[model samples]
Target: MGNFVRIPAGPDQSFDAWIEEPPADRFPGPRPALVVLPEIYNVNEWARGVARRYADAGFVALVPDLFWRLEPGQYLPYTPEAQQKGRDLYARLDVAASTRDIGSALAWLRARADSNGKVGVVGFCLGGQLAFLSGVDATPDAVVSYYGTDLHKFLDRVPQLRAPALLHFGETDTRVPASIAGEIERHKLPEQDLVTVVHPAAPHGFSRTGYEPFHAEADARAFEQTLSLFARTL
Candidate 1:
């Protein structure tokens, strides 16, 4: 249902992105779009798989290879040795550069036939933080964040997205400590609209199957609620 391709992000720089379209027989006309953001691994098989799932659900899904600026088509491992490399690469990333690349994808979607010009942002881990930030630059239809990494650190940077927002988190996620998540829950807004769901037994990456160590049975419930949020808002 999809494949990877390279596209220009800025002058003399190209990035890889997984573009997923629903089967031709299933998708007949223009549809909404979803920008699928990845975890620390950038655009890995799992991330692409998620894009396909979104496409199956009637969205044009795009997963960009954020690490491409440094190395094209790179996928780091979760091992201790590779973890250091991933951290180094993560540290080198310029937030403005990433938002620029993401904006390019959004522009492509809005102009394409499969998009109704309605866009939503969804991501896990590092990508989740970006999802929140993306809201500041543009008005998306909605934003969904899952156990967002470093979002608490940039809470001040959190965009007052006029669009509705739904956040999912794990109560036990040390990466996004419960304390900070609580603070996020306590904030007031002009819209006074935000949904924050905490999966009691899960931790960071709880929505992912392979993160079974931290996964919870309740994550399924959270997912259903997330879909409902999209339906109501997007």
Candidate 2:
């Protein structure tokens, strides 16, 4: 369970976000926060479920509506039509503006009364790219990227990433084939704290529950790795 909130993004602009907070009795004081990025499906049930998962794990989770610029409050279903529409929106997106919204979301989390002033970002699919891009803008405590596609485009900014990062990839994913992921790994700066994992027998959307490629063992391991990262960094 979460509620919608408006977070200021830019000059005269704000976006909708889904806020899931941990139970007050369980977490009486400020708690660590996480910015959970959704897939191309936007902030639908699956995305909200992720936010809730983080809440149940004792962290305040926030899911920003990444498509606010073009279609505010629009939640796309998991269908062919929705996928095409999401791809269109993703293609036309202004990278600069999207990163700004991410910065705003992180800032909002840090300033929340219930926040412990430490925030970690975890993203899936398209959101995975945003998680990497956030390093170029905001220096969050930690970042976890899952099967992010087209990361080769942001290799130039790898040196700017200051936080510890855990990147997950499915060995069988055609979208981010081993060759491409290896290139990304090669670009990792010597000083950057990064760990890259390639899971065998897993596909593109292995972490997603209802997806055909969903692999429980791989997803659980990935999540455990993520929690360990945040535990040490956040």
* Backbone atom clashes (below 3 Å) for every candidate: 1, 0
Candidate 1, residues 1-234, lDDT tens digits: the string is: 688877666678677789998776887776888888888777777788788878888788899887777766767655677667667778888877787777888877888866778878888888887887777666677888887777766666544655678778888887787566667766636464677777776777787755444464866787688678787776
- C-alpha positional error of residue 160 in candidate 2 after TM-score superposition, expressed in Å: 1.9
TM-score for each of the candidates: 0.90, 0.96
Residues forming the 10-long window of minimal summed lDDT in candidate 2: 176-185
Whole-model lDDT, candidate 2?
0.86
Q: Alpha-carbon error at 57 in model 1, in Å?
A: 1.3
In candidate 2 the C-alpha lDDT for residue 7 amounts to 94
Model 2 TM-score is 0.96
Question: Cα RMSD to native, each candidate?
Answer: 2.0, 1.2
lDDT of each: 0.76, 0.86
Off by over 4 Å in 1: 214-216
State the lDDT at 5 in candidate 2. 93
